[model samples]
Target chain A: MGAVIYDRVALIGLGLIAGSMGLRMRADGLAGEVVGHARTARTREVALQRGLVDRVCDTAAEAVEGADLVVLCVPVGAMDAVAREIAPHLASGATVSDVGSVKRDVITAVGPHLPDGVHFVPAHPIAGTEHSGPESGFPELFEGRWCLLTPLSDGPEVERLARLWNALGSHVDVMEPDHHDLVLAVTSHAPHLIAYTMVGVADDLRRVTDSEVIKYSAAGFRDFTRIAASDPVMWRDVFLNNKDATLEILGRFTEELFALQRAIRTGDGKMLEDYFTRTRAIRRGILDAGQDVDVPDFGRAVLRKGTAG
Target chain B: MGAVIYDRVALIGLGLIAGSMGLRMRADGLAGEVVGHARTARTREVALQRGLVDRVCDTAAEAVEGADLVVLCVPVGAMDAVAREIAPHLASGATVSDVGSVKRDVITAVGPHLPDGVHFVPAHPIAGTEHSGPESGFPELFEGRWCLLTPLSDGPEVERLARLWNALGSHVDVMEPDHHDLVLAVTSHAPHLIAYTMVGVADDLRRVTDSEVIKYSAAGFRDFTRIAASDPVMWRDVFLNNKDATLEILGRFTEELFALQRAIRTGDGKMLEDYFTRTRAIRRGILDAGQDVDVPDFGRAVLRKGTAG
Candidate 1:
């Protein structure tokens, strides 16, 4: 266990990200006490039963009462409501952060609701699985993963939150809120939407049938299914909250897709080959950044349950 | 190792599939002696040095001379040429099969080239890594993977070839050529094209620099990079040869994507949530079918360089 970073930390949601944070914090003794609140009583029961948190509170307000660190782990769409609910109860010098994919929206939603003394630091951990809920979290989900922090003001609280994420086994980087949204639109948001659309298209295709698509998924569609299987409410909120950036990326994607479609229609092998080669270099860069390994089949077998570190 | 399935097997192109097949066949004693041929002498040398084959032949005809089974493992666009090259050398009663993603194209390209006495069974193994070439093969690549065999005439030769694949640790199924093309368009071909297009779009985006996309790829774009990093020549051949099926699936994908885009533009949260929920079920079916695992992160770690079996 590492040195304690917070006296008491409250997570406003008991889903995958929050549950994982609680588990990792407890595992490493990053926080003296880890408290959490979920909207549903069933999730709270599961959190307590699964040892995801030291204690489960009845409401977001009660959960943040004396917590020095309060992380809003609710869906992006619900950030403002949850922030307002817990604002009056925030500790005197507490730091309020989040684990949302889109940063700009979170800033706009949760910023005004937070009290003046409470520090607001918007953060996005570039780590997750398709699974959600209290039972779907593991301690090492953030290890070797990037957690981006986009702070409104460069304050000591931001550094403290960075240290906490470091203690949680993440490499943290500070970025501007708008830049974070645009980068995520290119990296996470748009790719996820595309995956969902492709899977939906496969479902709607009568000629292929659903069973055949599932049966032959190992070919390539299986990867898309994994991404598409992520929490529905969470993704819905992400798309709704990050509308402008997501739409911009999607627009670029559609244009490129059309160009490639034209090339395919005209049987232009050269264009296809050139485009594929340039994109291959991007994978190499990701590997070089240590974000992933060099294995060909995506190193899939090692990151599964019971095997992950 | 099991009993030998073929006394002598000849592999036409020493790429990923052929190399994996040769290694798996030898590891399981599925074939007595595996002979291989590649377009380049360097690949032929790598094939023998890496022990992917027992012997390396300079030409395709020389490789197929006395073999009981000759498997064409070249790209889809080159199948016709390779089949013609080895046609005269195919032994009497020998079965010639292929490992192409598109089956209808393979049948049209290689069917008439085979002599009357020789059997032609087109097959595609629904398994691969982004890495290609002779040195990339491994013995366990085909274990628990599906191998589809599309035979022109359902003869004993088809059964024998199926037994060979079975011994190589693959579950074999017979599918019609056109149906195979359609299924692949939905499962493999279309998904690959989509991934490539997404990666291409990211590369073309001026707002998000290439390095940022690579550094933050742990989001979802990394998955597309893996798919896009596949051999350019092979993908070029796949798109060109499977034009009709791929274009059809692409049209369907575009329609679905436009609907989702409209929903996002209109701020229809319910539509997004319901669509995501439906796509989530497809993933469950794939996991239930044992085509993939329930492991959330795609089990990526186990297949890394120093960690895999």
Candidate 2:
């Protein structure tokens, strides 16, 4: 624990990311006091019971009343309304940030509603699990992950926010919001959309049957299933907000897929081999870059149990 | 370790699956005096050095001289030549099986060449890692994984092969060759094609550099990279041999992907959320079936290491 970066930090929307932030902030004494607000009273109660927050407020307005830092950790679609409701209650000169995946859209939706003298630095911590809700969070979620801070301008507030994330155990990177979206499209959004599509296709396969697909899924389709199992509403909002970049990446993916399909239909083994070899290099690069350190066989640890059955 | 199922078992290739089979069979004493052969002397030497086989032969014919069971573990494209080379030298009443991802193609390639009194039972083990070669294999590779046997006949020979696989630590399922191909198309082939296409698209992106894609890949693309990193020659053979089924499943995937893309374009959150929710259920079904046991946050274990940078 270090010196408190913010005397009081308010987190709106007590879900996985928000709850994770609360736990991480408290663990490191990044905030003197942590408060939280959720749309439903049940979630607020869960957050309080889980010790994700020191105080649980009934409304976002009340949560931000005396807090030096307020983070909008809700879905992208709900950010505008929350910003409108809490703008009047924000403390003077307080730094306000958001944990939305889409940055340009978030800035567009929430920037105008903020009161004067408040900072609107949008950030995205590229870390999560398939699990959601306040109970799904742990203090170690952000360790060794990259957190992107998309600020319109560089100043003391942005530096402080970066330092706070550093304390939370993330390697912080400052990027333009558009670049962040395009990079995310290439790395996260498009892949997730494709995984969802693949799982949907397998589910809708009449010939193979869903039961067989599920039973034999350990081969390869299981990876797609894991990615597709993420929170539905959060992903829906992500696609709706980051439409342009996601669509563009999807277009490129479609083109590449069609070329491979053609190669397969034509019996062009060399073409397929060349393409596979090239893509294989990217996986090596990811491992070399330390972005992915998972074992080649992910389920080995689980399978190593005494009972093979 | 248990009683030997075969006096001498011949593995006709020295790759991950075959090497793992040798290690596992030796570990459990499933086969007496396991021998192996590969087209390249380098692979033979590696297999011998790694103890993947007791005797590494220079020729497939030499490897199967006195063996009661011969497993063709070469790439799908190479199965025909291997079957031709080893057919004349096989012991009478010996059982022959191949671990090719596509069954119908293997049957077509190797069925006519097998001599009378010899049994041909095609099997496809639903297990592998991105790493290849003899050194990559381990005794536990087949534990808790499925090995699909697509035999043309239901007889004692098929049951023996099933028992052999069971002894090696895999759940065996019997299906018709054509049905196995289609099921694998939905579960393995098409998903692998999509993953390769996604990685290729990211590699070819003009705006997003490869470094950026690799760095931010911990989000979702990392999973695709792992799938796409599989053996290039093996995957090429898979796409080429399983063309019709893979292409059909890919067509369905494209349809589903376009529907989601349109939903994103029109801001149809309901449709997107509904589709994601449905796919999420399939993931749950897969987990419930015990096909996948790892928590969704695969990166956490690696991230927990002391080096945050």
Candidate 3:
């Protein structure tokens, strides 16, 4: 929308987030040179051919060379290696950040490797889809979404770089790294784990029922399946990276789950009614807060994808 | 599409399902005459205003009189009272059916009171939206959806009625009444209860942090809360009716949930990975089965009412 924020920006891992970053930067005229890197030559070539970046480089170091900003868009597990690889090549005073789902994990994994002169800012853009690869990223992905930046109190330069996200198209929030992880574990990770697990259970039942699972899934199981179809490797990395917070929130979830099980087992209609009534209110609050885009029904939206049944 | 299947079709309650039935019947010329009735006069007025039925009757008895087909379309808990109110007035050769969530309970509640010559067919159309009332109905609601019918085999009349649904939009599947309840409990009722419970837990957390439980519900919580917002009285009746099946399935879900909790607590990334991977296949199967309609995400189909957010 205005002059470029940085003369050159390096995107490590030309996957969904990075490719999307490239698209967004190009659309908004935010970067002079959008350099993308992938370890595999084939992926790097594909990224270049697909016009995902102004330039393609096979190594993170090459991509970061002379770049004013560097963004690590790989899985959280891969952050340290990329950080170390690109650190020496990053321009002096260049700001480095990421689009990792877990903030504290990224800081721990990538922070130590960043050079003193290159500012390191850890951030998480709370948005995505099940699709992956360079083709999946688009400029509009971050519009109106929350981008949380967790910077050390003394790191003013890094904090300023984090504000670039707000300039691009995001509402910025500042939170302690650990708090970010804990809140996400409850809001996103745990819920995903539950959905993935329930879908697996339903699939197992489908086998015994001679394929009735998919047949009748429209009744409920289909929603779980759609979420479960997410990129497995990325989710595995998320759980491994943010172990403690996930475990903490999961404990609370199970305690509540068991109480519900008890209500169902003993036919405590009153408890069920009370619990159900309370939850319905939460949905209303969501609507009032405008956190959720109003969709008539999840199943109906699923139908629109038209990719699946 | 063909000659009207029945000379007269009486819809006992003009809510979503019943109104939908009337629309579908008119669209395909599946009924010779469509009559609507509701417990309250206001609903009848709304039905007539919406042209949901050809004739709006003042009483349930008046609606059922001389109709070749009668459908009881009320909450599962109300099956007994509605059935009794309309039973004596039903024409001798008329076939009576229902669109309830729980099969055994509907059959139990409505079976004994039916006249000797009248055929009783219990059906559950495994489709709905969070919104209720006459305005929620649409002709395409049951398109490509499964309709489960549990009917005694002795009557040719019941078989003819099954043909009627086959002529309409639904794919009809017949099963044992008790087994129907069990299957639905596993696939629908139990999941709805768990969703309601989890949203309740999240709602409690919202109270403490004043967080946006509904607003920022990613995929899992968003989907859960959407299903949880289903009609409270209808869900309560469903739970009361299908207590045994729901409790049995809830037991299985809790056992699985605790194992997952333990996996998270112990930092067993491999176990979590194993479970998450297992679930992705179900999405593929649903996609292959053509049951889950795909949308951008699992956002709901847009509703014209703009009432339920």
Fraction of native contacts under 8 Å reproduced by each candidate: 0.83, 0.81, 0.57
List the TM values for chain B, per candidate: 0.96, 0.96, 0.94
Model 3's TM-score against the true structure = 0.92
Where model 2 places Cα greater than 4 Å from the true spot, the runs are A206-210, A302-309, B206-210, B302-309
CAPRI verdict (incorrect, acceptable, medium, high) for model 2: medium
TM-score against truth, every candidate: 0.97, 0.97, 0.92
lDDT of 3 by residue, B142-202 (tens): 7777888888765787677777777766788888888777777767877787677667667
Candidate 1 CA-lDDT value: 0.88
DockQ comparisons of all candidates to the true complex: 0.70, 0.71, 0.52
lDDT of 2 by residue, A41-98 (tens): 8999999999999999999999999898999999999999999999999999999999
Interface RMSD of each: 2.1, 2.0, 2.9
- What interface root-mean-square deviation (Å) does model 3 yield? 2.9
Candidate 2 chain A — worst ten consecutive residues by lDDT sum? A300-309
Docking class of 3: medium
Off by over 4 Å in 3: A154-164, A298-309, B154-159, B298-309
